[model samples]
Target: PVPVFKSELTGLTLPANAEIIAEGFIDPNELMDEGPFGEYTGYYSGNKGKDYPKPILRVERILHRNNPTMWSTTVGKPINDIHMIQSLNRTATLWHDLETMRVPGIEGVYIPAEACGRFWAVVSVRQKYPGHSNQVGNAVIASTTGHYGVKGVIVVDHDIAADDWDRVWWALSTRFDPKRSAQIIDRGRSTPLDPGLPIEAREITSRIILDACTPFEWTNKPNEIFMNREVLQKVSDRWNDYGFDGASPVANMIDRLVKPEAIKTKKK
Candidate 1:
């Protein structure tokens, strides 16, 4: 369904979906089910087949060019184009929010595409303070989208790429201890589209925070042992000379799996 834009004060309604807009606040009490419309969670949320209240967007005024395109995004599964946009947004917003909280040694953040831009986040930060990984995980749980479908939040050291699940998993395998490094919060509030929620209320769900960062208490040895960056870079620069391709080994593996011929052979 299309949304009709109208001015409450002037009673001026747009000819159609006009491009220009003005913003104003409205009473929450005045809200109706604005949607069972398509939501980013790949579901028709709100009162469609079920009784639910949707948030209302009250228009205060109207202004626009002769012809303007309305910015709209499709909501569906992970591969949908809009999911890509949301992924970028989640990464930026979560990164900024954690940085603002003064969590030290944050190198990068990535919200995986498979999580539909909301369900999971992977953070790469330098391990400094003991229990710092848990602190970062809790902060993420309190963030906007992070409070939603986020079933898991994995924290890794700066050496691992936040976007790479394999590396993240490796970090978890080597660094995380199930007893001391993982936390589960029951009855947490998550987005309504989360399939894990047994009730319709947005305030009820559960989540796990995994501290994949290396244990700081292991002071008997160095936390990380790796080639120096300058040396690594020099090796990387001449990698081709050593008969190795510069392309990612992971990407090459994915290519083999997704190749059309491979699919046909598997089907046969």
Candidate 2:
């Protein structure tokens, strides 16, 4: 039971923190098509088909704060406010939903803003078995956040960071074998605003789960070379002595990490 606020103009009862109050409801017996708006996909979707009789809201009156700074943003482009807002919100939802579902080995989840947080989601896992990745993927696919719109999910070993697209691609290329690692489901709920969907079939979609990890079945796998922690810490402590204006290894690590062949991995 959430607290409610009664709007003076429309007499609409809304959640206490709701910024705006409107009198709107839909009768399942009635339907109307709406949209063709600039969707978050960075394209115009849902505008091509016939107008379905979707729910229409009749705003009797509107009420807001005295000096409310209306938060708004444009779609059809990545790295904008819309994507940023969706990324934070959708990522939180995905994380929480995964936790609520009790999915094992759930290390991290990241829904990148550049994709509008709908098309692609990345999950990091400490896989316990060969099907652990699939289990995690299935749980995510069935979760509330993943039950709709998300077309692709990539599950990577816990060593990889979900937000690091560069490493995600690296894992995909090195760890994923198309014939063996791909999982496809024929049908699922689709994003209404997906331009890639046939105008008539935008309501349903298929999903792809790419298991971007070295299969647990293998006994011997190539070891990933990483910077020595002790050396890294020593370098961090002596960062000022190396004549850098800032006492951080970011400037030193960025290029070296990107171009690993440029530097020799220190051996014990």
Candidate 3:
């Protein structure tokens, strides 16, 4: 658990280990025009024609630890620390939301930092009934973490890890039919920082959900091919005998396990 302290000025509890803390209040009626600063989208936010109106925080007092270290992050485009942070936080938040909503058979959830962390998500689900994959896809868009900013979702089978791009592409190629598995919704809450939408119409956005799992209701499902376990083990065990420079790739195939039912709720 994180240590906490009560602020003497605002009577609010805060993290005791923080490097710096400011006791402040924002007046509801007060507004100020803020910037066109560079955003995580790799483009400048706000407009030259219309300065964005934002509430200003009036600092009453500031507190800091001795020899405080100021932490900062760079946010721009994809694959940055900010994007990575956003992906991690969003993925965990989405998973938590799904667990709280009792959405079963979820194997994994991943929001790639390459998609700016807010636009696309991939989910792997174990389909237990007809239309189960579709239900999970829709649930992702409706979740608290996904209802805002997310534009696309890809749902795959349990055999595919959400973060494994190779398997994700393979599933899309072999199992998906655009006409049968794609869903397009026209209305969802949007973030103003989304450059895809017009500045004046940034409050609403469209979403697309692509289901890549095979239909659970089908009577004749395609058989999945797999290598013989005994043969694979033998080959891996004798890898060095073949004058290989490194260990067999099969030696590193420890499966990742995530139990949705065991997820704990985050404290406020």
Candidate 4:
């Protein structure tokens, strides 16, 4: 909270321990040019689209404490200032909003810190009926928080971990169909910081809903092959006997069986 105005001689009122103060009056009708600010998108956010004037604050008084410690921050880069500062609050808000939305099949919600916690999101859903994933995608787009700034929303199956990029990417590759599984919106609220759009178009951005889930209409899912538990257990029980060091039996078993190229391929 800012200091309140108290006495003319004292300027803005300060707490007993306070040492510095500055006073400003904002006339709502007064307008000024602002920005050319370095934004969280790692690009300069300049005046874009229609030039909207900014409010002007006129400083009338200044006071100082004996010594002051200034607090400031820098931005740009994913999971950095932009991500760290806003991710928690914004994700909480999104999760709350989605909860209230009551969209069917919704199991979990996440906003990727890689998008400064605003631009991209993922929703995990346990598909209960045909078109359930699409319902989630459209509902999220029209929901309160999703109506603004969010450029992309990916709906994944409940088995996929929304917060894990590896799982998300795997689902995206195997489940997403360029011809059928995407919802493309022509426009939605955007900001000047978006670098992918033209300056004039930054006021609104194209939204995409990428559905990374199997079609719920299917009668049966492809049976996935798995390693035998007995074999895995024997390997784990003998891991130390085989001289594998620094890793537990469970870790050794995983390393023995799972390889980057050996993941289940997408069903035809």
The 10-residue segment with the lowest total lDDT in model 2: 259-268
Q: Compared with the true structure, what per-residue lDDT tens digits does model 4 show for residues 69-129?
A: 5556677667686686676777778778877887766778888778888898899999999
Residues 154-246 of candidate 1 have per-residue lDDT tens digits of: 888776779978878887888888998889988766666665454356657778888888776676844444333344445556667778876
> Which lDDT tens digits does candidate 3 get at residues 1-268?
9999888788899999999998899998998777787899998886832546888899998899999998888978798999999999999999999999999999999999999988999999999999999999899999999999999999999878999998899999999999999999998999888999998889899999999999999999997755544566677799889998787886554221222222222122
How well does candidate 1 match the true structure in TM-score terms?
0.66
TM-score of each: 0.66, 0.75, 0.79, 0.79
Query: Which prediction has more favorable lDDT, 3 or 4?
Result: 3
By lDDT, the best candidate is 3
RMSD of each: 10.6, 5.6, 6.7, 6.0
Identify the runs in model 3 with alpha carbons over 4 angstroms from their true place.
1-18, 21-30, 48-51, 57-66, 240-243, 253-268
lDDT of 2 by residue, 1-268 (tens): 8898776655667787656555655456665566667878888755643445565665556656666557677777787888988889888999999999988888889888988867789999998877888888877789999888888899998877888788899999999999988989878988767878887778889999999988877899977766655566577777888887775955456433532443435421
Q: Order the candidates by lDDT, highest first — what do you get? A: 3, 2, 4, 1
lDDT-wise, the better of 2 and 4 is: 2
Q: Which has the better TM-score: candidate 3, or candidate 4?
A: 4
Ranking by TM-score: 4, 3, 2, 1
| Winner of 2 and 3 under lDDT | 3
After TM-score superposition, the amount by which residue 107's alpha carbon in candidate 2 deviates from its true location, in angstroms, is: 0.7
Candidate 3 C-alpha RMSD relative to the actual structure: 6.7
